[model samples]
Target chain A: MTTPPETTTASTAPAPVLAPPRGTRLTLRDASIGRQGTPVLEGLALDIAPGEILTVVGPSGCGKSTLLRTLAGLLPPLAGEVDRDGIPITGPDAERALIFQDDALLPWRTLRANVELPLAIKGVGRRERRARAEGWLERVGLDGHGARLPHRVSGGQRQRVQLARALAGEPRAVLMDEPFGALDAQTRAGMQQLLAEVLRGTGATVVFVTHDVDEALFLGDRVALLGTGTGRVPHVLDVPRPRDRTAHDDPATVELRRTVLTSLGT
Target chain B: MTVRHLLRLLSLVAALGLWQLLTAFDVSVWLRFEQFPTVVDVAREFGERVGSEAYWQDLTDSLSRIVTGFVLAAVAGVAAGTAIARSRLAADLLGPVLEVLRPIPAIALVPVAILLFPSNEQGIVFITFTAAFFPVMVSTRHAVRALTPVWEEAVRTMGGGRWRVLGSVVLPGALPGILGGLSVGIGVSWICVISAEMISGEYGVGYRTWQDYTVVDYPGVLVGMVTIGALGWLTSTAVEVLGRRVTRWLPRTESRAEAPAPRRSPSWGRSLAGAADPGPLTSTKEA
Candidate 1:
C-alpha cells in the first residue's frame, strides 16, 4: 500500500489516478536478484492487479531491469518470493510474458514467423499458430506483415510486432521493460495509445518500466517510483482515467504527479 | 579500374606474368617452361580432359567425397552448436577445446590421420572432415549465441518446449551464420581433401598430381593444381548461393557477416520520394 500524499488533484499539473480492482495478477514479495555472486537488486515487494497498468519509473541502472528480469525468469531471484495467483515463482512460464525495449526480434525471422516463434516453441500446430499469430497481428494493426523480415520493418513496427508476439500467447500478465522508450516521441505516443487500447480490450495485467513520469501517469493504473541504487519500495501513485493528460482536471491525480516527480529525486 | 577489382585482377595477372617471366628467365630448370609445363600446356591438358569420360568421372568421384564430408559437418555442426549454446556447461567444456584445435591447419593433420586410419582413403576423408568441422562448428556456435533473447522469450511465452525453441527460433536464426561457416568449410574441405589425397592416397586430383610429379609431367601437375583451385572456388560459390536462398529473411548485416567489407546503405531516396508520405530529406529508415 502506498502512502497517499497531500491533496493536489485540483492543481493544473498532470498527475496519476487509480482504477479499482479486477483481480490480483502479479505479486512480488521481498524479491531480490544477484549476478555472478553479487547482489544487483534488493528486497522489493509490489502487487499489480488484473486489468491494471502498473508502470515502474526509476533512475538508470537502479536494478529496475533486474527486477523485471527476475519477474520474467530470465534470471533467478537471489532472495524472497514472487507469487502468480498464489503459486510460488519458478522457471519462466507462459502466464508471465516479458517485452524488451530493444524489440530483439530474430534477424532471420519474418514478422509473422517471429510472432509465431513462441507457439512453435510450445510445439503448437502450424495452422493454429498461424491463426493465433494472424489474430494478434490484426489486433496490433500489422496485418499482412507476416512475410517481412525484422530488418525490413521500422523500429517502431518491430516493437509493435513484439507487442503482438507477447499478446498472441494470451498470457495472464505482460511485463515490459521500457518498450516505448527507444521510439521517437510521436511514435511512442502512438504506441502508448495502442497499448492502452490493447490493455482495455484484453484486461491483462501489465507491469511496465519507463523513465518518463508523464508516460507512467498516462498509462499506469498505478505507478511505482524505484530509487537509484539499492532500489527500495516504490512510492506507488494512482493514474487518472480518460487519460488526455496534457490538461489534468483532477486534484488527487495532480498531487500524486507532484509527489511522484519529487520521489523521482529531480 | 575500381581499387578492389583492380587489386584482384592485378594480383592474378601479376602472379601469372611472374610465373611466365620466371620460366623465360629459367630461374630453375625443373620449374621452368622447358622442363616444366607452360601455362598453355596446362590449359590444353585441362581442355583435353574435359572431353574425356574418365576425367569427368574422376572429377565426380572427388566431388562426392568433398560433398559427403561437407554434409556430415553441416548436420553435426548445427546440432552441436545449438546444444552448446543452450547449455552453459557444454559450451564451457567444449568451446575452449574447439578453439584451441581450430587454428591448426587441416592439411597438417594428414600424417597423424594416416596413422590413425587403416587406409589412405579413410585418412583423406578424415582430413576433409576435420577441415570442414571447425568452421561449421564456429559458425553454428556463433549463430546460436548471436540469436536475440527475445526469440527465446517469445518461444517460452508461447508455451514452447526447449526442443521447439531450438528448432523454431534458434535453428532458423542461426541459419545465415551456419551457412557462412559452411561456405568457408566447403572451400577448406576441398583444399584439405586434395592435399590429403596428394600426400598419401591412390586416386583423385591430389593423387594424380603426385603421380605427375613422380613422372616429371610438370604440365599435368599444373593442370591438377588449377583444377583443384577451380573446383574449390565453384563449390563454395554454389554453397553461398544456396545459403542465400535458404535464409532469405535474415538481414543483410547478418547474412554477409563473414565477408570483410563494410556494408553501404541501399538507395532509398527514390523509394522514399515515391512513398505515400515523403520526408523532407530522403533516406531509407531502418524499420
Candidate 2:
C-alpha cells in the first residue's frame, strides 16, 4: 500500500475524491470492558479482519455497546489489550469514527455543516471542506436538503447525514452502536441497503452492534453473538452469503440464523 | 388583521376604558380612585414631558446605565459561568463565593454601591450589573453543564482538541440557555437600575418620579411611571426577539402547522427516490 505524504499544512487538493482509506485490523485479546470501574463483558478473544463488517447482536444488557466503546478508545479496557492494526488503542482517533443510535447530528448545524465537522477538525480548507461535504451529502441522497437544519429532515434522513458525517472523515474503521435501531422497519431496511451501497470502495472496517437478528445476518460478513454474563467468549459465525437480502431463505443462511437466535437464547 | 391580534388590541383598550371610567367618575370603591390623576390629566402630562429636555435627559441617563451594565454583565457572566461549569478548579474557587453573594437582593446593595463608587452614576450602574450578573451566570452554568456529552465525544473522535470542542460545541449548544438568561437579566437590570436611581440618582426617570411625588405632581409621577413601563417593555422585547433570531434552528411546531401538505400519498416510490413526505415525519410508519 502506498501511503500519501502527511499534509501537515493545508493542501489545496483539487478533487473532492479522497484516497480509499485502508481498513484497520481490530483485535481484542481476553479483554475486559465496561463503564466506570466495573467490567460488563469479560474474557473476550476476537480477531476482526481488515475491511470486514462485523455485526454484534445480543440481549439488551449484554454490554455490546461497552465493547464497542472500548474499541473506539472512549473507554479503557478493564483488563487485557485492545489493538487496532497492532497498536494499542489508548484514545479516540479520527481514524476510528463512532456512529450513535441517537442520530447525534448537532441540532444547531445545517446538514452540510454537520457533515463538514470532521473535515474541519482535520484542518481541511474551506473550499475543499464544502466541496467534500456536498459530495458526501449527495452520496447519501440528501443533496438538496443540505441547507435544512437537522430537525427539518426526517429521522431517516438525519441518519443518512450522520452516515455521511461518519464517512466524510474517511476513518479506517467505523464503530456503529445500533445506528439504525431508531428507524421504522422499512426505513431501517432502506438504510441497511444504503449502508451497504455507500460502504462499497471505502475499505473501512465496520463493527456494527444491533439487537435485530435478520439485520445482523444480512449486513455482516461475520456475526458475533454475545451471550450475557461475565467471562464469556462471544460465539462468532460466518455468513455463507452476505449482503444479499434474498438469501434469507437459503438453507445455510437459515441454519446460521436459527443458531444465532438459539445462542442469543431469545 | 387576524382575530387573535384584534382580540389582543381589544383587551388593552378595555383595560384603558375601565381605568378611565373609574378615575373620570371618582368612583372610590375601596381603592382611592378619587385622589389619582384622571386619564386625560396623565395623557396631557405625558405630552408635556415628551417635549421637555429634562425628561429626555432622564430617559437617556437611565438607558445608558442599563445598556452599559447589561452588556458588561452578559460578557462577564458568560465567561465566568463557562469557566466555572467546565473546570473543577474554577468551580471550587468561585462557586461558594458566588452562591453566598447571589441571594442578597441587588437593590439592597444601594448602600454598598454608594459607599464603593466615586459617583452616583457609577454606583447605579454597579447595582444594575449586580442585578443582571447572577441570573446570566446561573443560567449559563446550567446551560454549559447540561450540554449533551455526545457532542463533545463526536468532536473529540474527529481529532478536535479541548479548545476546539469548547468553541465548536459547548458555546453554540449553551447559546439558547444563555439567551434565556439574557432576557431575564435585562428585565432584572431594569428593575434594579430604576430602584437604584430612585435611591441616589440626580437625573433619571426614577429620581424625577420621586421628585414629582415630593412636590405632589400626581400627573408627572404617572408620566414617569408610564415612561419606565414603556422603556422596560421595549428592552425586554428587544432581547426576546434577538434570542429568537439567534436560535432559529430550534424546531418550531407552529411552522409545521402552516406547511403545505404532502402532494403525494405515502408510497414506496417517494421512499425509493429518497424524498419522503414533508409532513411530520414522525407520523409516517411503514406497515
Candidate 3:
C-alpha cells in the first residue's frame, strides 16, 4: 500500500473525495502511558498509516484503554509523545475523537443531541448540525430513534450512537477504547461489521482497542498484540487487505489469532 | 380516587380523630389536654383567622421573606457550588470557609444575624438565607463533583472551552443535583423563616403563633402551624414541578401504576420527621 507524505499540521477538514488511499498517520515514539503519574506501558514505538485500522489486543488491565486515552489527549503521556502527522498532541482537539467503552452518551441528551455534540461544540448552526446528526444516526441504523434518550436505547444501540457521535465531527483520527466491549457476543459481531462497513472508504486513521483476539483480527488492518507483563506491544502482524468477517477465517488471520491469544497468556 | 389516596386520607382522619379523642376524654396524664385545643376549636379559629386582614398580612410577610431569601440563596449557592466544584482555586479558597460555616445551624445564626442586620426583617431574611444556602450549595457541589469525567472530556475533545463546557455539559449534567438542592433548600428556608419570625419579627405566621401562645389562644397557634405546613408543602411542590419540567430529557422510571402515586405524600411525612431523607437526586434512569 502506498502511504502519503505526513501532513505537518493537524487537519480538521473531512478527507477529500479523490484523496490518496491512506488516512491520518499516527506515530507514537517511545511513548509511556499510565494512570495517575506512574507509567504502565512504555517504549511503544509504532506508526499507523492514515485510514489504517490498527487494533491493539491484550489481556484485561493491559493498558489498552490508557494508550487510547493518551492518543486522544485526554490523559497526558507519562513519557515520550504521540504525534498526528508531524504535530504533537498536547491536549484534546476536535481532530481526534474517542469512542468510549461505556458508550458515554450524555444522559441528558437525546441520541441525536448526543451525536450533535461535537458539531455544537464547534458552533455549527442548529439546522445544519441537526441535519448532519440525523444523517449520521441514519448511517448508524438509528434513523427513527434519534429522539430517544441515551438510557432509553439498548446497549448496542447506544454504542451505535457513540460511533455516530464520534464520526459526525469528521475527525482525522478515531481512538476507540473497546467501543463494543459492553455488547453481547452477537451484538459485538454486528457492531464490528457495521464499523467495518462505515469506515470502508473514509480513510480515517483508527486505533481500536480490544481484548477479544478474534475481533482484533477481524477488524484491524494491523493487529498489535500487547503483553500484560511488560505493558508493551511485543508483536505486530499485518493482515491482508479488505479485513472483514471473511478475512476472519483466512489461514493467515487464524494463525495470527493463535499467536495473539498465546501472547495474551490465554 | 385510588386506594393509595384513600389510605392517605384515612391516615389523616385517624390522626385527627385520635387528637379529638384525647381532647374529649381530657387525657392530661403526660401532657395537659386542657392546654391543647380540640380539632373543632382549631378549625373554628382557622375559619376566623383566614377571614382576617392581619392573618393575611402575616401569611404574606412570612411568604415574601422566605421566597426572597430562598431565591437569593438558590442563585448564589448554585454559583458558589459550581465554582467550588469546577475550579481548584475557588475550591481551595472558599471550600474550607463554607465547610466551617455549613455545620453551624441556621437557627444558631439568629443572634449573629440580629446583630449583623440593620433591622429584624433583614435578620429574619438572613436566617432564611443561611438555612437554604447550605443544602443548595452542598447538593450542587456533590452534583458537579459527581459528574462523569467523560461528559466534560467529550465536549473538550470537540473543541469546547471552559464556558461552552460549563453551559453544555457541567450545568445541565449537574441539574438533577441542583434541583435536589433547591427542593431541600426551600424546605429548610421555611423552617428558618418561621423560627426567625417567631423569635424577632413583628408580623409573620410564626410571630402570630408565638403571640397567640402568650395570650393563651391555643387554637390560634394550631391554625398558624397548619398554615406554615401547607405553605411549605405548596412551595416544595412548585420546586419539584419546575424540576420535572426543566429535566424533561431525563428518563422517567414511573410505571403506569406508579404514575398516580404522589411523590409529595411520602416527602411530607419525611419532612415532618425533620428533613431526614435528601429525596431523589440521581434516580433519573428508567427502571
Candidate 4:
C-alpha cells in the first residue's frame, strides 16, 4: 500500500527500466500429463527451443489445455519428466505466465491494476509498476483505457489486457490456452497479428493452444497436433517461414494444413 | 413521480384504508377485526410516543443492541466462512458444530440465553448475534466456493503465494455473496432480538410492546410493530446500498445502455453486435 514516490519534475513519461526478457528452454521427456490420476496425453516428448512459438492444435478433449498446464507448472505431469532449463518444475513459477481462454482478468480490478498484478506480486515499486503497466497497455493498443474494469470493456479488450498483464511480468515463457478463441473472426485475426508483433522483441517462449487449424498454422513457428484418441503422441510439424495471412494458399502450407486437418479428422 | 412509484404508494394507502374500514365497521369474520386498533388510534398513539423520553430510551436501546450484535456477527461470520471455504482443516473443525446449531431457531434459545448471560441485554444481543451468524456464514461459504478456479491459477502463475491469492482473489471475489448474507442476517437479527427482548425483562421496544399488550393498550402495540417494521427496512436497505457500492465492479445490465464506447477501436462493432449478451449479470443477484 505504499504510495509511489513524488516526482521532482513535471514530466509524465515513465522511465522504462524493464530488463530484457530471456526465453527459457522447456523440455517434456516422455511425459504423461492429465488431471487427477487419469493420463490425457501419454508418452509426450517435446522440446521447445528458446524464444520459439509452438502452437498446439487438437480436437476437443485431446488434452491440449492439459499440456499447456503441464508446461506452466500448474499441474505436474502424472508420469515422466517436465523440466525448464534442465531443472524439473515442481510448482507454478513467476518465470512462466499463463493466459486463459476465459476472461481471467480480475473483474474487481481496473485494466491497469490487472496488468500491474504480477509486478506487485514480484514486489516492484509503485512508480515502476505504474510505468510498466502503462507501457504494456500501450503495447497492446490499449493505452488510455487502463482505468476501465474488465466488465466495462469488450471481451476482446479484456483479452488485450490479459496479454498486457502477462507480458508485464516479463516472464521467460508465456503459456496461452485458447486466448483468442472467444473473439470474433476479425478480432481474433487482429489479436493474432498483435500477438506476433508484441512477441517479436520480448524473446519469451510461447506455447499457444488452440483448436483452429488456421490459427495454429499462422501463429506457430512449429505446430504440434494432438490426436483426439488417448495414448496418441503429438505429431509435430514445421510451418513454412515468413508468417502471413495469404501464406495459407501456398502449396506447401496448404498441404500441411490438409495433413493437420486430416490427422484431426475434421 | 413515475407510474410505478405512484402505484407502490397507492398499494400501501389501499391496504391502510381497508384496515381502517374493517376495524371501524367491526367486520369480525373468521378473523376478529372488532378487537383491532384503528389506524387513527395507532397514529395518535405513535404521535404521543414520539415526543416522550421513555419511548426514545426504548428506541435507542433496541438500536444499539441490534447494531452491536450485527457488527460482531458480520466480522466473525465472514472470517469463519472464508476459513471454512478455503481450508480443509477449518472446515473439518468448525463445519459440524455450525451445521448442528444452524437449524435451531435463535428465538427458541430464550431459556439458554437467559441461563448463560448475566444480563437481559446481553442475552438479547447474544440471541441477535446467533440469528445473524448462520445466514452470513452459509452465504459466504457458498460464495467463496463458487468462485472460478481460473482466477486463482492466473494469480499463482504470476508467482503470488497463498496469502496474496486470498487477499487479491478469494476475498474480493466472495464479497458480493458475503454482503448478501449480511443483508439476510440483519433481517433475521431484528426478528430474534425483538422476540428475545419480549421473553425476558427489558426496556426496549419489544418489552414496551409486551407491556402495552398486558395493559390492553392495542394502539401502543400497533405503534411498536410499525416502528420495528420501519427500523428493519432501514437497516436492510443500508446494508444493500453498502453492498452495491463495494461490489460496483459487478456488471449491471441496466448500465450497459449508457456505458461509454469500447476502449479499443476494433471492439466497437463486436460490442454493438453482442449488445444482447447478458454477460455475468444472471449470476449476480442484487439485493
Docking class of 1: acceptable
Q: For candidate 4, write residues B107-224 as lDDT tens digits.
A: 9999998899999889889999999999999999999999999999999999999999999999999998999899999999999878888889579888899999999999999999
DockQ class, candidate 3? acceptable
Q: By TM-score, who's the top model here?
A: 2
Q: A133-200 in candidate 1: lDDT tens per residue?
A: 88777677666556666676577777888888887766767889999888888778778877887777
Looking only at chain B, model 1 earns a TM-score of 0.76
Write down the TM-score for model 2: 0.88
Cα RMSD of predicted structure 1:
9.3
- The residue-level lDDT of candidate 3 at A171 comes to 86
lDDT ranking, best first? 4, 2, 3, 1
Q: Which candidate number would show the highest DockQ if scored against the true structure?
A: 2
Off by over 4 Å in 2: A1-21, A241-243, B1-30, B33-35, B255-258, B261-287
Tens-place lDDT per residue, model 3, B209-267, is 99999998999999999999999999999999999878877666674423543233222
Interface DockQ of each model: 0.25, 0.34, 0.32, 0.31
lDDT of each: 0.75, 0.87, 0.83, 0.87
Report the lDDT tens digits of candidate 4 across residue range A206-226. 999999999999999999999
Instruction: Put down candidate 2 lDDT per residue, B146-174, tens digits, no spaces.
Output: 99988888777777788988888999999
RMSD in angstroms, all models? 9.3, 5.5, 9.2, 7.3
Tens-digit lDDT string for candidate 3 (A82-191): 88776678898888888888848888888888888899888899999999998998777767566767765568778888888989988888889888888788778778
Taking the true A–B contacts (Cα pairs closer than 8 Å), what share appears in each candidate? Answer: 0.39, 0.36, 0.35, 0.47
